[model samples]
Target: MIIELESVFNTEGLKLPFDYELDLSAIQVSGYSPIAQPVRVSGKVENKAGIVNLTGNAQVIYTAPCDRCATEVSKEYNFPLEHTLVVALESGENDAFLEVPNLRLDLDELVEEDVNLALPSKYLCNEECKGLCMSCGKNLNEDQCNCKAPVDPRFAALLDLLDE
Candidate 1:
């Protein structure tokens, strides 16, 4: 959604309250493989002192594999996004608008960024999750595997030293 900032930009005290819902299930984030479900974003954009201040709340459902157990899990996340966008007088004159085009705000990009920042670095179903057994590829949380644990040959000398 591209909001025209002409009105807000011209007036100092102008504010635009916007409510937008977007479907992000089809969009794929780079590092985060999980896709977000349709999200509701409601926010206010205020133009004060020649700066556009946007503050909003977004609610999204995220589906990702658990880090410990490797099970697919769906979680709901809400993130608050607040940022200042300065309108450039010219297209290439200002550094802020250099990366992004002037006067046009990419709502999709902003929403994607907010979702990415809200995600956790690591996700686990539970803190005490036993994860999976490497030897037999068994889910340790369900049951124990009968396979014996392998010991490194380099650690054999250390084991003998500990015995002495």
Candidate 2:
């Protein structure tokens, strides 16, 4: 999803409106593959005195397994994706600007990064998800387990004394 920025770069104070679909199939999460969806890329790119600027958002709906309950869950994300594009050698390798080759912007890659950065470290089906039971592998939210609960190792000594 590379777009040519040469024309946009030629004129000072020039602005170009762009909209495209971003594919997120390549990004990987811990236990689940994010369902590939077309993320919206909408914004205006401008050339201000030889500097390439972009102002817009990368929006998408991502589906993945819940980290706690293992249930399939979907999350909505709309992250701000703005960057100052700079020529690699000319910018002196600063983190404040994004460097590009051949005056092109990888729109898909940029949006993908934004989506990844916005994703939560942990995903839960809900705030109250009870998760799966260790004893019988039953979903605790659906059914309660009657199996003896495993005592914490720290409390094992107290349980041994009580048995005696």
Candidate 3:
């Protein structure tokens, strides 16, 4: 969806609502594409005294395995969206501005960028996940392992002192 903002580019108190579905499969983070469904972005763009502002929410259903236990984890992200739209800037290096090329703003691009920023770097099945036992290769959450963790050689002397 390319928003036609030329009408409201210079008008104050003018708002135009835009809807778009952001495809996030192209980008991968942490060896997984978290988006199981299309990221729905519904919001509006307003020009306030020549400043084009986009405000909305990007929502998606993320399904992936937990970082620790390898169990399936699902998350719904309704990320708040706020962006500054500009026709042209002195420099394109700044991250703060979203350049509106040819008098239009790409809604899909904006939503993708916003959702990327909002998603968590790490996904957890739960806060207290015990993960897998190193020795037995068993999920600790499901069953306790009988294999004891081997003591490091550096700590062997101190451990022997306790045994004495």
Q: Is candidate 1 or candidate 2 better by lDDT?
A: 2
Tell me model 2's lDDT, rounded to 2 decimals.
Answer: 0.78
- Model 3 lDDT tens row, 66-100: 88789988888799888788888765458777778
- Give the better candidate number (2 or 3) by TM-score: 3
> Measured by C-alpha RMSD in angstroms, how accurate is candidate 1?
6.5
> Candidate 3 versus the native: TM-score?
0.80
Candidate with best TM-score: 3
Poorly placed runs, candidate 1 (over 4 Å): 29-33, 89-101, 147-164
Q: CA lDDT of each candidate? A: 0.74, 0.78, 0.80
Per-prediction TM-score to the true structure, in the order listed: 0.70, 0.75, 0.80
- How does residue 161 of candidate 3 score in lDDT? 88
Give per-residue CA lDDT, model 2, range 50-160, as digits (tens).
Answer: 888888988778788777678887888778878888756463556557877678887777777777888778788898998876557778788788878844545867777
Q: Report RMSD (Å) for each prediction in the order shown.
A: 6.5, 5.0, 5.9
**lDDT-best of 2 and 3:** 3
Task: Kindly list the per-residue Cα lDDT of model 1 for residues 1-95, writing each as its tens digit.
Answer: 87777788788999988898887776554455575567898898888887778888888877877787788888877788787776444555543
